[model samples]
Target: MTDTGREEVVREEVARAEEELRAAAALLTAGIPRVAVTRAYFAVFHMARAVLYAAGYEPRTHEGVLHLLSLHFVKPGKLAVAHGRVLARLHKYRGEADYGDSFVIDEPAAAEDLVAARDLCERLRALLPDESNRRE
Candidate 1:
């Protein structure tokens, strides 16, 4: 993709991250912890994608995104290992929340995931250029 195209993708992913965060919060407020956990994970996932796209990467799968994130950012110490751990943890929790027949995400767990997701998104957002600098 051209630089403009990549920028557009990055912007879209950032928007998605923001939207997912809102949805997660709303879901949690509505007493839907399971779906909230999934949305929380997605928030961080989209933020990761945005950061990767800003750096010219386009991971094809969720695992690919995690691997690339560790290889490019965490291993290089551009991001803290804790950030990577949070993403991985959320990924695992999201799987359980979405796919595990008997798995349950309580409100507290979903709330913690939301907090972690917000932190990860903030950290990832820091790696990108300021919003004002990007073309609309």
Candidate 2:
């Protein structure tokens, strides 16, 4: 993709990330911890994709996203290792919350996931070029 097209994709992914964070917060507030955990994970996932796209990489799977992020950003010191750990934790929680019939997430854990997602999103957003500096 051209730079402009890539930037557009980054913008869309970032927007989706923010939206998912908001939904996660709302769901937690509404007392739905399981779904909230899932939303929080997606928030981080989309932010990871945005960061990858900004760096000219496109991952086709969840594990691929994590691997690319670690290889391209975390390993190179662009992002903290904790970010990778949090993403992995959130991914695990998301899977349990979504598919594990006996798994349950408490309110506090869900809230923690939201906080972690927000932090990850902020860190990933920092890696992108400023929107105002991009050409229309």
Best by TM-score: 1
Q: Candidate 2, clashing residue pairs?
A: none
How would you encode candidate 1's per-residue C-alpha lDDT over 15-111 as one tens digit per residue? 8899999999999999999999899999999989999988999999999999999999999999999999999999998888778998787899789
RMSD in angstroms, all models?
Answer: 1.9, 2.4
**Candidate 1 has which clashing residue pairs, if any?**
none
Among all candidates shown, the one with the greatest lDDT: 1
lDDT scores of the candidates, listed in order:
0.90, 0.88
Candidate 2 lDDT over 1-136, as tens digits, reads 9999998898888888888998999999999999998999999999899889988998999999999999999999999999999999999988887788888878997888789889988888888878812322
Query: How well does candidate 1 score on lDDT at residue 62?
Result: 97
